[model samples]
Target: MKIGRNEKCWCNSGKKFKHCHYGRESEQAITKGELIGQSKNIRSRKCCYVPKALQHECDRRIVNAHTVSKSGSLIEIADSTNHVYGLKINLANIFKNKGKLVPEKIGVNQASTFKGFCSKHDKQLFSCIEDHPFNATEEQCLALMFRSVAKELYAKEGSLLSSEVIKSGDKGKQLADQLSIQKFAADNQLGIKAALRELSDFKDQLDGQLLGNFTNNLSHLIFESSRSMPVAVSSIVSPVSDFNGTIIQDLGDLNVVAEQIVFNSFSSDGKGYVVFSWLTKSAIILGFVNTLIAIDKAGIFGALIRLFFGLAENSFISPEWWDGLPDAQKKKIESLIMSGVNPFKFDPKGLLIDDGVNFSGWNIDNIRKINF
Candidate 1:
């Protein structure tokens, strides 16, 4: 909300404050009894139409989503234009120490898709134990194992992960010895396969330890990326501290990636929402959702959002009103909003109203009045 005196207006038209929406008339109209309360005749040029115009436009196009996550709760702020969304994933349930492989914790931190690459990563090392003999170069073989391990836990671009239920490593080993060393050599004909098999069960344990370290580093990078914005919820499913506390090189760069994501998310949201928010800066549209309604559906908003936010003309959304948008356009909107966010202030939390209720869920009680 705080902008510098000479800053490019967040409203984004390329003009200075003296010439933009906040021009002379706008500066004068904020006085007396006109700007704050609701009035049906607000569209008249002499009134508060200008400020309301921006808010209303933003509201009309902005997408409102509420998720009941296993972690906690999620509120996303996006429009056909801006992609900056905020999710408050709660982990209070997991830290209680009662459950195994906490879904809530993993979902909040990792946000994995449960698809392709993650599955393969898990099976990689085990597959190697089946194929290559022990005489192979442990380092390179380990790399293969690392990739496989990563795939199991991480989702890859393309591949089938086991849909069958997975067993805990400890419990699975106690019950089924499927994860083994000798089987690795029998399956692989590599030079070191046989030698690796001779290293004993204790060696596999060491390999597992090393694998944890490797995965931890990768997971850390993934986590920072997810939280820092441009808003592609991270694909990782666990927190980094779980990885035995290994320190990584270039931690600073990881944060940069986070900033990139955050910035992109906001910009995308601003642009996508422009579909609703961008009117004749002259119209008196106000409120977030109202902004969306103000859009002229024909091609004006679509053009501005696309040209400015890089959104396509069509995007796929299922709400009754959303049917008006095409899938490609929606995707483009998402991409543009994501690419234009601000990293330092990433993730668009819900707007700050003068204590308004956020309607969500089916029950009438879902509406909680706020006094703040």
Candidate 2:
């Protein structure tokens, strides 16, 4: 079980053992401040959306683009202080919350924002969804899906880039702890790499459509809420099960690139919209969508709340509504939300079913399906 000093590190860091983990236990542990700084540095490196044709059109300044529009969606749910509750996923915040992820009050301007696009392209590309009303048009749906996927792609790349900082926690730890941490990091990196490949492909397709000024091979389902919901979210999920507890895709299969679908929810024009968008002719996603439609109109909101907390992390909650929930209910929802993003958690079965918890009282007014 002994590794040669010149051999690759047991942690799979692609460095020799002597240069990577050898004598790591004797080193000083990475301070919390260091980890925070490293994370900030990673985030500070901006990424822009510049296709081959638009490279010359990109702006010099990279802006923090909102996946969920700030002017239209987030402002509708902001409290008196213009803030909303967002799940903080940093190591310091997680440790502060006793090793659990919790929703922290964040300014609406900062919530759901990512430095994923330049100012010029951000304005030009997302004008339909960002500047105007949402009527479930093909352009608007494509914009919605584009922003969701782009945000997710940026996030996954960040997580992958932060692996070294994460592995630094193994410093000054016992060999067993170091092994556990490194193994988890290695496994997580693999997952992120797989996700990045799929996201890059999807983004390329979206970029092609944007460049061609056409919408093709896109499908969407839009559910109109009779009233505004207290939450706004933009995320991508590879669904494993449906509302009926039937498995539609096996997310555990390492060889398969799991089917992904974009789920976005926001309030616009005095009503709420829950949108699901995906590529064309995906039987797996189609089945998943069918189960969602099969849910009774009365219970659709509850089903969506469960599914959102179970699978998505880019969800924001109105401070007023979240504060009104009972402590036990909030705890239950937090656990459900963490189950989706926590690397150590593995229970993905029956994530969309009713769990005897209802977080929304809004009713579905209409359901619209679009194929193009």
Off by over 4 Å in 2: 1-11, 174-176, 326-328, 340-346
| Residue 196, model 1: Cα distance from true site in angstroms | 21
Best by lDDT: 2
Q: What lDDT tens digits, residue by residue, belong to model 2 across residues 1-372? A: 599999998887799999999999999999988888888888777978556687787878999999998988899999989999998777667668887777889998899988989999899889998889888887788788889898888888899989867788999999999989988888888888988998888888788877775556778888997677788999988888878888777666778878888989999887899999988867788888888899888888888878877788899998888888888779878778777565566566656787777665578888998882
**Candidate 1 lDDT:** 0.24
TM-scores for all candidates?
0.16, 0.92
Residue-by-residue lDDT tens digits, candidate 1, 1-372: 445557774334466644443332223232223221222122111211111222233222211111111111111222333222222112222234332111111222222212222223323333332233222234323332333222222221111111110111112132123233223322332322222232222223335545454322110000011121122221111111111122212212322111000000111111111111111121121222233333333322332233223221112121322334566644544444443234464322211111121111111111111110
